[model samples]
Target: MIPRYTTPEMGEVWADTTRFGRWLEIELLATEAHAALGVVPDADAVACRERAPQTDAAFVAAVSERERITDHDVAAFVDVVQAAIGAPAGSWIHYGLTSSDVVDTALCLAMRDAGRLLVSAADTLIATVTDLATTHRDTVMIGRTHGIHAEPTTFGAKAALWALQLDRDRTRLRTATETVAVCKLSGAVGTYSNVEPAVEHHVAEALGLTAVPATQVIARDRHAELLYACASTAATCELIAVELRHLQRTEVGEVLEGFKPGQKGSSAMPHKRNPISAETISGLARVVRSNLLAALQDVALWHERDISHSSVERIIVPDSTTLVHYCLQRLNRLLGGLVVNVDRMRDNLWSSRGLVFSQPVLLALVAAGRSRDDAYRIVQRNALRSWEEGVDFRQLLENDADVTLTPQQLDEAFDLARSVRNIDRVFSELHSMASR
Candidate 1:
């Protein structure tokens, strides 16, 4: 992945040094696996392990430069290791192994590390959202449907939805990574025609991977699943971000992303304090989704394998992981520093002039023996009047001729806080959360 889309740790995951290091590790492990099964000299395996690390940054750079002439990345990498070990041991370096054996296995190693990071980032985001949810669980606000206030809700309930989704997203990424973490050293075309099946299993186990029955490659479906996992996580972050953006809008200033003292929202408009971080996460999410499409296309290949998927994987794998990691990390920070106005939320909740209570009022009317349609018509008539005249809805309902309810019933109907009184029950299962 490019620096623009990558954090330093994630950048290191896709770095040349990191890439060649895994290749060398797998090559050495495979050599020992062969030796353990009496297929290769034990001395050769030891010597190769000892020398492979000596092929450092300069050596990896030279091998990368050599790739232009060979037009083979794995071969260039093998050449560097072979040269470092020399003679008889060099001969044992990549014996009975095809390019995909090293490339795919090394990719698994890198992905395993990257997956752990992504899962951790997700966990942190979930925890942060949980904290916010617990704190604001009782803070009432007007919930919207299709850009119109629909009913009363608590800000904590909204955060709880995000926290639960991110917990699932964390699990999804972890599962997808495991699916992609399998190693395949079954020689070319993956029949173990050249290398024994035991050798593949032995090497895979040593590398902390499970070898799968495969084609020339480890199959693109696993890779596709990993991409989809990242896209799903990105989509979740975007959902949270989109909501934050709406909440931060000038007309609906119920919540806001942190604004540093030196931060500037707009060059011309001094009053502008935009939701830049949320907008950025939403933009990056689109890229993650598009990458999943490319990965899905990679699932179909020419016969045993093809290079078409290889090129795409090289870009999408790291890019998708890095992008999702960034979104997760940034969202956690943004939420931690979030400025939530309890007063503003209350103001917005009542801004609809008590019409947010219409549903409860309608239901109360229906429960009192009126037909559903008749109750709805009566409620909608008063609700519309409140909308047009800015009159309180409860007052309109109280004055209606058809309304036989006493002041007590109207109090239950118009009480916005009453609607969210039981919200703490929703967080009961989340004991690790602040379930106040």
Candidate 2:
């Protein structure tokens, strides 16, 4: 992943030093397990454990240089660690174990850590959206269908919808993390021909992972699911960003991405204030979504194992996780400082001159003994006249003799408060789902 989108904490999780440290820990744990089974000397296991403290930056550097000569990463790592531990302990370091046993298990540790960071980012974003919904629970706005005014709605209801989706994203991220939190130390072909099953279990327990069936490596389905979760969450963030971008349009202007002091929206246009943050998020989301296809493609490999998935995974896993974390954090900040124009929302709601209240007026006519077809004609006639002539719809309806609604019924039909009466119910349902 590029430095521009990588958070420091997530970057560290996939760092070379961290990967090497995990690799060495798995090696030592397997050695100790062998000692417990009386397959290796206890003193050699102790020496291996003592040597772990020395496996730091210098150790990682040596492994890198060795890889240049050996042309194989895991082999180079084992060679360097074995030389560091020396003699009797060095002989037992990689005994009865294959390279995938250490490499695949260590990769799980890295992915598990990265998954936690993504989950935490999702939590922060959910909180920000929930607060927005709660704060604007009564802020009314126009609801549009096909870019035409349809009814009166609250901005709070829009935000509550987003919060509910974000809650689902959080659940998916947690589940994906759990799905990949597994270790597979089974030897080549996954039959444990040389390495015992107990060694795999011991390493898995020490690393707080579950030992699962495998063929040279843990199944790619688990990793595919993790990427899918990231992609799904990114798509959700994009959904929010696209809406904010539309709201920030000059014609709409119901909301704006918070612009910091001295921030320039455009170099050539001085009066411009753009939704750049939301646009950036929308762009990054595409990358995360595309990575999911690569993960899905990795699910099929030749026979028991092949290196085809390895190269692709080396790119997708870290990059997908980093991009997701960055996008979620950016979205949280964008919403936290979002400037909602409540007064403008009100102006926009009534911009159509009472046309949004046509539904209630139509229903009132039906209740007053007018046929459904007759009521539709009466409402549509006045609505079209009001739409084209810039006259208030209610006034037009009043002048129309075909409209049988009484004065009290007309007032009730155009009531903005009545249109949003069920907003509280939606919020109650949202809160209930959140608590669960």
Candidate 3:
């Protein structure tokens, strides 16, 4: 990942030094495991493990520079580590291994570590949305469909829906991460070739991973699964951002992302307060989703393997992870200090002049012995009249000859509390699910 999108903790996970260091650890573990099985000398294993810590910035840079000439990163890395060790003991390093044997295994560990960070970021986003939902549980607002007011609902309900999506996203992501957290160290064409399966198991266990039988590389599907998880998470973030953008619109004005004092929304417009964070999330989500294609395309390789997936993954993995990390952090901060307009929410509920109450009115009329079609017709007639003339829909219903609803029934139909009567039970379910 580039520095611009990287956070310190996550950045370290994908750093060249950390990457090379992981490679060293994998090689050292294999040597130690091989020593136990009499595949390598005990003295050599100890020497390599003692020298493993020598992997630092200079050594990593040396490997990077060496790759410029060798054109093979894993080979370059092996050479650098062996050179640093400077002994007959270094001869045991990377024995009986192809580049993918070490590269793919090390990559799995790096991906797993980075995945945990994404999961943590997702968990934080879930908590932030939960807080907003609980805080605004009773804050009544108009609900819309097709960008038109449809009914009354609490702002908390909207927040709860977003939380639900993230919860599902996190579940799918956790599963995918586990699937990708596997090590493959079976030689050039896999099949264990010259390396023992037990040695692979021992090394994998030492790295806190599972050993999976592979063909030169751990399956590309595993890599694609992680990318799919990221794309799914990005999809969820976009859903939330889109909702925020709609609520924060200049005309709607029901909510606003936090705009610090002196924050500029525009260069020339003095009163502009844009949904910049939400818009940012929306735009970056496209980038994350697009990476899914590259990952999926990497699934098909030439024979046992090819370098096709390698170059694409080098860009997508860190970019997708870092972008998602930035998005989660940005969104959490945006919602934490969000400005919700309770008064404006109430105002917008009536912005349609009681058309939002049409369905409830229709239901009450049906309960009052009117036919369903007759009730719908009456309600639709009143709603259209209200929309065209900006008149009160209730008065139109009151004056209608076809309407069978009494005054008390009509007023009850228009009651905002009626739309939210079952909300507490819904909130109860959300809270219970979250607790688990």
Candidate 4:
């Protein structure tokens, strides 16, 4: 993740200093657990905390050089911390824990922080979409199917749908956070050969996590669950991007990305105001979804564990979190500054020659003693003629004797107000959910 796309707060979470600091926290927790059991001196535990604040940049820089030969990140980190803490106290640093005791647990702490940031971003996005929907609750627009006007629906309804989907994404994300918030201090093959189960439990409690029931390296499935949730959330983001692209199309200019003053859309075309934000989000979604394959592949590691999953996770976890955060923040800002063309939406609603109100007319005729088949035929006939001949569907319905309804009844059938009568109910539902 580059500095440009990554926000300062989230960027810090993935920095080496921060990751090293989290690793030390996990190590200290383990030390505290050992000290409580009389495995390490209480004074040594205090010294451990004071000595190892973080793996300093100068020390990490030098230790990374050692990692080239060692071919192990956790080993290199341990060696660096040992030098900082001096011999005796440093010897008790990772007494009864394997590399994963520190690696996986510390990774959880970092992920927990990252998840909190993503949740905040998601909440902001949902609020922005909901606010926009409320403002445009009655802003009529042509609801299209296969790129052609099929019926009338409010722009608010479409935004509300996005908001609702985002809400589900939020829930999925929260579950992912909980699923991964577990730690394991089991030795090499998860046998408790060197470390006791009580030590693992105590360490987990000290680090604000739960101990895994039985596992090797904290169970890769939890990691997979989080990635799956991230990919699914990215899919929802892509759905919004697709919609924005369609609305910004030249022929259907019902909405647009905000065109800030002096913001150039293109060097060649001065008149162009592209939906770049939406397009960028759409492209980033592919990256997130593609990473999911790696996550699933991570699930089938060799026996207890393997390095196969390790390499993939180093990329996916941080990248996915950063990408999702980037997308949510960008999307929220885009929606907040969205340029809605209410008049254009109303104009496009009628561009299809009143055919949008066809369903209401068809159902009205069915209710007025006409067979469903007969009513469908009457409405479809008039709709097709209006579409082909550029005539009003309502006028054709009024003239057709098959449509036994009076002029007033026909007028009521074509009313846009009637089409969106349930909008209030929908908005109320969203408002209630958002408040919670």
Candidate 5:
């Protein structure tokens, strides 16, 4: 992912230093496990541990320099670490282990940490959206369907729906994190031909991961699931962004993204306050979704294990995680400072005259001894006139003798309160979920 859409914390999780550091940790843990099993001498394991080089810039550069010659990253890393440990103990550094043993385990560690950051950002976003929802619970607005006014709804109700989706996204992130929190040290053929199963278990436990049965590499299905979860979360962010962008449209003007004092919406236009944040989120979501396709493709590699997934993972894993983390944080800020135009919302709600209350009016006529079809025809006639001529629907109905409804009945039918009377019920459900 580019720096523009990457958070520093998430970027660091995939950094060379962090990757190499995890590799070294896995090696040391495996060495200790071997020593416990009496496969490697205790003294050699201690020397290997105590003499291991610090995984800093120097170490990373050395590994890169070695990789150029070996043309194998894991092999080069092993060579570099062996030299740093030196002598008799250095030979035991990666004994009874294949590249996947260390590489896959280290990848899991990185993913676990990166996932934590994403989940935390999602938590903050959920809170921000919930706050907005609660604050706007009674802030009435028009609901649109297919770009046409449908009925009255509160901004809070819309925000509450978003909050609920975000909550689901958070759950998905956590589930994906656990799905990938697994280590496989079954050797080149996954049969543990040389490395004992106990050694794998010890290292996995030390790293707070589970040792799972696998081939040379951990199954790509696990990776695919993680990527799918990220893509799903990104899609949720895009969902919210798209709605916000629609609300912020010039014609609508019901909501606006927060604009910093000096921020310019356009280089040429001074009167614009564009929803750039939401637009950015919607755009980045496509990238994450594309990455997920790549991950799914990775699941069908050649035979038990192959490097076909390796190069793709190097890009997709970090990019997806980083992009999602960035999107979530950006959305949080966007919602936290969102500018809701309550008066504009109210005005927009009635922009179609009284046509929004057509359904209620139709039902009222039906209750007044009219056939359902007859009631619908009566309501549609007046609703169309109100829509086309900019006349109040109720007045149009009152003037139509076939309407067959008394004034009191008409008043009860067009009541806006009836449209949102159950809004409190929705909030009650939301509050109950929050408590749990």
Candidate 6:
């Protein structure tokens, strides 16, 4: 992943240093596991662990040089670690384990840590949206159907929908993390020819992963699931980004991302405060989504396994995780610092001269014994007249002979509060999901 899209913490996790360090740790642990089976002496396992950190820059350079000849990355890594410890202790470094054993398990560890950060970011966004929903529970706005005002609704209802979606995002990430947290030490063909299933079980327990039943690698489907979850979460963030972009439009001006002091929206335009962060999240979401398609393509490989998936995983896994983390973090900040224009929302609510309240008025007339079609026509005609002639829908309905509703009934129909009478129930539902 590029620095522009990657956060430092996530970027560091996938750094060569961190990756090699984990590889070294896995090698040492495998040696320890083998020692327990009397495959190596306890002294050698301890010595390997003690000297494991010494596989530093010079050692990696030497081993990478060896890979130029051996043409195997894991084989070179093992040779390097063995050279660091020397003689008998070095001999037990990668005993009874394959490259995927170390590589897949260590990848799980990185993903576990990344999942924690992503969930935290999602929770932060959910909290901000929840707070916004509660604060604007009665703040009315015109709800649109086909880019035109269709009905009345509170801004809180819109925010509550976002909150509910984020709750689902958290659930999806949890499932993805669990699915990918699997370990395999079954060796080449997964028949446990050299290493026993018990060794795999123990190694999985040691690394806080579940033992996979059988694997050429730890099942590419698991990786696919994880990438899809990450991309899907980013897609949801894009939904919010789109909404924020729409609301921040000059014509709308109903909501805006917080404009920081000293921040510039344009190079030369003096009066500009754009929703750049929201737009940023939206833009980066495309990268995450594109990476997920690559992960899906990785699912089908040559029987047992193939290295084709390996190279792609090297790019998609770290890039997708890091990109999603950056997006979630930025979206959290955007939601938390959102500047909602309640007065503008209220003003826009009446922009169509109470035409947004047409549906309720139509329904009320139908309940008063008018045919549904007749009620709809009456409401539609009055609404179109109000929009074009700047007359109030309610006043027109009151004067139209075709309309049968009483003044009291018209008053009830025009009530936006009545339209959102279930707001509290919706909020309660959002809170319940948030608690989970």
- lDDT of all predictions, in order shown? 0.88, 0.90, 0.88, 0.85, 0.91, 0.85
lDDT of 2 by residue, 61-90 (tens): 888899999999989888888888888788
Put down candidate 5 lDDT per residue, 50-155, tens digits, no spaces: 9999999999999999999999999999999999899889999888899989999999889999999999999898889899999999999999999899999999
* TM-score for predicted model 5 compared with the true structure: 0.98
List TM-scores for all candidates, in order.
Answer: 0.96, 0.96, 0.97, 0.96, 0.98, 0.96
Model 4, 418: alpha-carbon shift in Å? 0.9
Cα deviation at 353, candidate 1, in Å, is 1.1
Which TM-score value belongs to model 4?
0.96
Q: Per-residue CA lDDT of candidate 6, range 75-132, in tens? A: 9888877877888888887887788888888888788778877888788888888998
Model 1 residue 256 lDDT score: 86
Candidate 3 per-residue lDDT over residues 40-84, each given as its tens digit: 889888988887656678887898899999998888888888887
- Weakest 10 consecutive residues, lDDT, candidate 3? 49-58
- On TM-score, the candidate that comes out on top is 5
| Candidate 4 stretches greater than 4 Å from native | none
Clashing pairs in model 2? none
In the predicted model 4, the residue pairs found to clash are none
How high a TM-score does candidate 2 get? 0.96
> Model 5 segments beyond 4 Å from truth?
none
For model 4 the local lDDT of residue 76 reads: 83
Ranking by TM-score: 5, 3, 2, 1, 6, 4
Kindly report which residue pairs in candidate 5 clash with one another.
none
The prediction achieving the highest lDDT against the true structure is 5
Stretch of 10 with least lDDT, candidate 2: 51-60
